[model samples]
Target: MCSNYDACTKPERLRMYFGVEPPPRIKSQVWPLYEAPFIRRHPHKDVGDDAVPAREAVAGLFGLIPHWAGEMTFGRRTYNARSETVAEKPSFRDAWRNGLHCIVPVECIYEPDWRGGKAMPTRIQRKDGKPIGIAGLWTSNTKATGDEVFSFTMLTVNADDHALFKHFHKPGDEKRMVVILREDQYDEWLDAPASRSMDFMRQFPAELLMATAEPDRGKKTR
Candidate 1:
């Protein structure tokens, strides 16, 4: 589903529009497409963070694949992981099992809808400028050529009243929203007992989210 939302061509322009400099992750890949804001703002960024290396020079494709998967054209670009069932998904099970640490940086993410036979898009973001730390699962994949591909999946939970019901309502379904973590809560999320990660992730506060539909300025590139 996230495939429909093209990466922001000039994600760095977010700084000019948002009036703040992006984090290292954001500064590095602000062109071609928009990535998660918190990822752009990650504080512990390095080639190998806690024994895990960056999958790509920058962010990898949004869809996540498990290390055991066989070669395929698309391999199913599953961008979002269901909070309720992440522990059971074939793709996300091991990463979570191995205690992989991941950060999904994002500024505003776009979603489209049709009303009165016309299309409209919503730009969702925090009212505050702080990047939303979307908790995720990451893994390392080795291609036939031997290039390592590091990938991640954003965990999803029911939307908050402010984000899901307030601004994200669509015709058929708006039941899902990406999980956003607070700075103080990041450690708990990253270090939570596997038994509790899903529970802790499902209850993201609603007040932190703020959004409105905009005539897509189409976030720009470097």
Candidate 2:
């Protein structure tokens, strides 16, 4: 699962890449519980008209905070939801059932390569150096202090048979990778219903991704 990643924080880049106006300020690096921007279908889009934009960008915590969560700390462990159990897990079921699909725009994703009997942080990005749009779920919650908080979680799929992602994680552990969507599928993914959302939860092509072994420099904090 991806717990840390480089976000596409520039407003102009976000506008061009995701087709939405992002928040004025967004962090470059995102960790669990960190603030980041996600693109989702406009809530009022159903009001009917081409005048309403189909998509909108909103800033939210990187992790997911279920409605039943008592505090923001609950998000720390909900950053990544397994596709197999997302619809059954307490932390993700509500969002999944409600079809709260979203796209998490990222410059690259960081994962650990556990070869050579040690762990090496690897930076994985598209071969073209373009931003990736990862599939995720978003939800809104009310805090004990009467503040409303929006949060999201990246959806992950089993990658045990994947050519590239199979090398990540521990030797015996199950391999997993985030669901990356193609540019053409962006709108389709957001508009997919709950029953069909899983159709997009598949691994990205290994040939389109390039990885470099770069150690974490303590620049990102949890």
Judging by lDDT against the true structure, name the best candidate: 2
Candidate 1 global CA lDDT score:
0.54
TM-score of each: 0.67, 0.95
Candidate 1 lDDT by residue in tens digits, 1-222: 233332222445433332233333433232222333323223353545654422222455455656776552333555677777777878778777676756565665665545544546666667776655567776657852267765567777765353353344455665577776766665566556666766656545556666566775464554
Candidate 2 ranges with C-alpha deviation above 4 Å: 48-51
Residue-level lDDT tens digits of model 2 in 23-141: 74568789998999899999999998888888988899999999878889898999999999999999999999999999999999999899967889899999997899999999999
Error of 2 at 77 (Å): 0.4
Taking all chains together, the TM-score of candidate 2 against the true structure is 0.95
Give the range of the ten consecutive residues with the poorest summed lDDT in model 2: 213-222
Error of 2 at 92 (Å): 0.4
Report clashes for each candidate as comma-separated counts.
Answer: 16, 0
